[model samples]
Target chain A: MLKDEELDLLTGLLSEKYGYDFNNYARASLKRRVGRLMAIDRFPSFAELLHKVNHDAAYLPRMVQSLTVNVTEMFRDPSVFKTIRESVLPVLGTHPLIRIWHAGCSTGEEVYSMAILLEEANLLHRSLLYATDLNPMVIENIKKGIFPMSQMKVYSENYILSGGKKDFSRYYTAKYDWAKFDENLKSRMIVATHNLVSDRSFNEFQVIFCRNVLIYFDKTLQDHVLNLFDDSLEKLGFLVLGSKENLRFSSISKKYVQSDEKEKIWRKMK
Target chain B: MAKNEMNGFKVVAIGGSAGSLETILAIVQGLPKSPGAAIIIIVHRKNDLESILANLLSFKTHLVVKEVEDKDPIYPDHIYIAPPDYHLLIEDEHSFSLDSSEKVQFSRPSIDVAFESVAEVFAGRAIGILLSGANSDGAKGLLKIRESGGYTIVQNPATADMGYMPQQAINLGAAQHVLDADALVATLNGLF
Candidate 1:
């Protein structure tokens, strides 16, 4: 069992020296991530791990990447995109230029999914998509726009269920086990690294998709990230989340009204 | 009950699935009106239903028991329950957030997600308790809490309503205490 002193020491070092501030994240998750780090680094104790993380600049970023939740897929929870097609796209169609931000985008699947949706809606030409994640490796994969061919059949099904009009196979070409998405889809997206915990928002967006990412963070981090999303969005902008997620419980929940309750889509309240 | 010598709250994060209610009630009823830290419960279930587990638990314990909301402040002497279909996570500011992402371990409000998030935020200050679950989801997470210097408690498989979860936790070599549900409560009380 970790003594209270050890917890304090770890949180203190993370904040004072590294500026990560995990002091309030769910305790069990934090302990496990730290433990994994300890075993990987071959440290004998939590104290030694803390000392090393505080002193080593590289360690903190790596730790942050490891701690953050990175699981995601294209056209996940298909109904969410269906709602976007039915409700939000009409409003977005009116804009001459649209900026969409996929915050905490993991593995780039969702980014491509959004691109394909915009293309089918005939809005791709007028849209600029920015996909950002804390992990560089995931961002690199986003740049490649390639996914496992084995997963493509399921993804195609999800796209169709999400109300896609095009032949899903037209979007990618299979190269052995990998499916490289059409370059046309990739061209509209710019992938980068932006930390929701510590980094500042860089641009205004008409739509922000930060799905399932906040669940990994504790309430305070969720609030902070939501606030950032609110600030980054244009007036009456759209906010979509993973299907199981909702804005009902957050401090900022009142600021956004449900656009589609079942789909987990919300729009900024005027 | 003597107060825990530690200044900060000593969190006990509990994760369970099948046959957890009875075991949880037994442990909760046995605890004092106030323990030194907050108790957070993550129970896996389908997305559509309302959770009465909090109310059920409130009926059995004197501690303040309620469902956790996003940014609900972490406080001592209370039991917070994770709502259905959302993974509950701890914040740097000691609050909670629910994530509706893809379910880990094929269940929303997964024990692993909750355990991993708490382990990340609290490190050693956290105590992980794995009770009656059917899967191995809590095993890796309990191991993580142990590695972070947090105390780990697992119900003795013989005493648990279901033996799999507690047994798996023990197999992982993460549990510090593997007593029966009744004995586990007394042991926890002794710690404070």
Candidate 2:
């Protein structure tokens, strides 16, 4: 077993070598990911894995892919969407032009879900959804607007539960294993790779949906990203988070008041 | 690594995937009310639906069961259940953190992730239990708990609906006790 100092050296060198900062990630999870590679891939030791990451350019991308996740679904936690549809959407609809950001939008399922919600609410024509993630692979997938056909059943259920009035199946056309969503939804969305840790916030938006993305960070990094969101959000704009996530003790907690407490929805206080 | 004024046995993390809930209910029900230690539950779940696990478990247990939120304070006699999708982890001896990193063993709310964090915070004073499941998720985590000088247990494989999880932990030499449901309940009652 490696000592804590050795682990520190490895994580520090990873940032120096690859520009990915694992220093502020939760230590136990970082160890587990690295340890999994060791056991499954015959890395033998941290030194060997570090060497592979530094020497093999191809290996670095695969390592990053393994380290980052894209576990997402359409209308996930449908109640949160219901909160958006009933409360946030109406407020944003009053804006001359509504701008929304879906930070860490993996494979764009939820982005399309948002677009569908906007379309149904008659706000899609006036809204622009900016969906960004750190992973370029997922960004590319976002551009394609396709998902596994098998998941559409569950997604359809999620849609109906999220207060969808239209048939959920109408959003996508399925063939074999894949479902291609209606192209009209894509017109309102801009997909890009935006690393939350390294990049500055680009556009101030009316709502930011960075759900389930920040829980991986240590307290300091979590605060850092929260501040970034604070800078990017318009006053009285909405911010939604993952079910288990909260802004309770963060540096900017006082700046945002819990709007729909049960839904993890918050509104920036003026 | 946090200060352990309570003699190091202040945390218990139970890890399972499939076919383990019934046994979990029994253990939670059997444990004493207001036990000095904090009890944390980690199960593999993917539903975005409102969690009813804590609600269901609370009906059986004397303890108050609540779904975990990031930075939730650890409390004596309270049962904290991991919400779906996010991985539950300890921030320190005092609080917990949640993450959306890649799932391990093909599941989020990973047993290995939560168990490793518990081993770190509680060290030798902790207890880890691996129960019935079809998958091999908690095997390495149980090993980690034992290696960190904590006590460890697994449900007796012969009596398990899905014995593979307990069997894996036992095969890896992770368990100090391999007891049936009743015996398992008795052990927990005796421990904390």
Candidate 3:
């Protein structure tokens, strides 16, 4: 167990020096992540780790990247995407310009998946997709629009299941082991770093997808993030989550009706 | 021991999605009424319905059993059950906070959310238990708890009504004790 003093010290250093506040994060998980970092860096104790994080600017960002959950895939929970095509696309298509935000977009798979879906629906020209993650490396990768070619078969299967109209293979070209996606799809996307924990809502979005990310956060953080999503979404905007995720219990749950409950799709009621 | 010494509570947070009620009951039956530490139970449900679990378990042990409420201070010898449709989390001061946020694992009061919160609040002092759940919700959080220096216990897959959760937890190298529910209670009792 981390001593109270150590927790306080680390919390203070993180806030004072880095402006990254993990003080509100679930305690045990935070300590564990800190402990792992300490062990990996060969710090004798939590105090030593705090000192290094306070003085060394690079260390804190690396630590934040490590602590943030980044596991994601293209067309993950394919049923949700299928629901989007059937239900959300018609509403979004009515608008002159549609802006969709993919928050906590780990590894950019979901963002790319969304881009492809919009392209297929003939809404790519009118859609502006913003993909954001706390990790700059992931944001950069999203811009590059390249993925491992080995995973293409599975992703293609998911694309088909998600009601893709075109051949999934046309979206990307295999160069050796990596698949570089078409530049046209990447052009519609704006990838950037936006820390959901500390950052405020910047732009109103017609649709918001923050699937599987809140599972990593504690209740308070989850509530905060949900509120951020709610604030960022325009009236009657669509919100989607992973198959294993739902908005039924949230403060905003009453504000959104299930467009397709099984697919985890919701339309803002308020 | 110094009375004023800051002694962190050795809290055990248990979460289960499906087939958890029986497993939890069996484990609770084996645990002492007053184990000198607290146990928080998070069972996934669709709504915030009234729970009879505390009443049911009260017959089995002398521990005080009740559903947890927002900002309720965690007490030793008490079993705090998480209400449905809310994600239960532990504060730094060891109180409880309920979040009605988006569901994980297709269920509110997700095992992963509860266990992850416990992992944050308790650190090495926290103990995470994965019971007979059908899904892989608790695996990552159990791994997090174990990685943080806390003790981790999983119901033995062979003994579980649904083995997926325990098996996944074991696969993740999260469980330090892969015991039967009865043995798990005994291990926890013996820890202090």
Candidate 4:
């Protein structure tokens, strides 16, 4: 495992050379991930890891991917998606152009899930989904709209639990071991690389989904990201977080009221 | 009571599955109103909607009990139950962070994940208790807590509803005490 100082030094190096500011990331998970990376990549010591990262520019993306937690699934926490489908979508339907932003949309599973919900709600034609992430590789996957077939079973289960009435398999075509999502779902999506740590909010949104992304950040960075969400969210717009994440602890908490007390969906009251 | 031997400890991580729920209730019922350490319960669960377990446990104890949320601060005299479908990790000494990572031993909120994290964060100030269950999840983590100079206890296999879990801990030499439910209660109270 990387020592505290070594992790700090590496984060500083990444920031100085690559402008990736991971200094404000929560220390424990970051350390654990980096340590796992070193083990997987066969770095005997922290020095070797440091040397590889500092000298090999090609290794930067791998380092970043390993450090960020990207374990997301389609329709994850079905109740949250169910709440979105039942409560959030109807309200979003009122807008002539429903604009939704998926911040830190790793592998685009949740974005595709949202697209399916919009399609079912008969609002897909008018809605635009902006899917953004720090990793460009995942952005490419978003465009591909292909996920592992093994995951479809769980995703299908989640889809059903989220009040989805359609046969979940109809959303995608099975090609050997991969499930390729419908092309039409991708048509309304504008995918890009946007860093929550360094980038500004690009547009105001009726709804923003930044689930499980803030847990990796420290308190200061979490507040910063929440502030960014607040700026991007239109009044009466909704903001959703991970099952265990909270907007209540942040400076923006006062402006948002939880749309469902059991779910993490919150509406911008102010 | 154990005369406050558990006072300095920050976390008490309890891991179980299968027939462990009854044992958990008994342990919670036996504990004092304020045990002076945060108790974290990680049990294998299939349903995501079972906040019922939290409510059930809350009814048995005087301590404040709730399902743990991401980035929740750990506090003494409170009990935290791991939410379903997510792994609960000790993020640091003072707080917890939840993850939707791949399951360990076919279980999210795996005892191993929580125990290993508690071992790393709390070290000598941690306490690990493995109870009735059929899995091998908590054995390695109990060993980790012991190796880190923290205390560990396993339910006496003979007394357990399902002995496999505690038996595994015994096989690995992870437990400092092996006691029945009554003895376990007495032992824990002695710590306080």
Each model's TM-score? Answer: 0.67, 0.88, 0.64, 0.95
For model 1, the TM-score of its B chain against the native B chain is: 0.91
Q: Ten residues in a row with the worst lDDT in model 4 chain A?
A: A27-36
Model 2 whole-model lDDT (C-alpha atoms) = 0.84
Residues B45-160 of candidate 3 have per-residue lDDT tens digits of 64414556768877777788878755567888788898765667665545776554546677667777778777766677788888887888889888888876789999888978
Residue-level lDDT of model 1, residues A1-270, one tens digit each, is 344567678887767876766676655455545665677778897767777777788777677766666667778878788888888888999999999999989888988998888888899999999999877767889989889999988898889989997889999999999999999998888888887878998999999998877656655677888889989998899998765455765787888888765667788986
Q: Per-prediction DockQ, in order?
A: 0.20, 0.50, 0.11, 0.52
| Index of the highest-TM-score prediction | 4
lDDT of 4 by residue, A1-270 (tens): 356789899999999999999999887778778877988999999999999999999999998888887788999888889988888888888899999999999899999999999999999999999999999877899999999999999999999999999899999999999999999999999999999999998999999999989878888999999999999999999999987799878999999898887888899989
The global C-alpha lDDT for each of the candidates, from Candidate 1 onward, is 0.79, 0.84, 0.78, 0.89
Deviating ranges (above 4 Å) for candidate 4: B1-9
How high a TM-score does candidate 3 get?
0.64
lDDT of 3 by residue, A203-262 (tens): 999999987666556667778888999999998998876544557556888898888645
Q: Report the CA-based lDDT of candidate 3 relative to the real structure.
A: 0.78
Tens digit per residue, CA lDDT, model 1, B1-192: 102324577888988889887878887888776687888888876543554787788789888987875556788888988887567777543577665555778887788878877776677678898988788778888888888778899988886778998889899898898988778788877765
Q: Which candidate, 1 or 3, would have the higher lDDT against the true structure?
A: 1
Give candidate 2 misplaced runs (Cα > 4 Å).
A1-3, A37-42, B1-9, B16-26, B29-34, B44-51, B56-64, B101-107, B133-136, B157-168
* Chain B TM-score, candidates in order: 0.91, 0.95, 0.90, 0.93
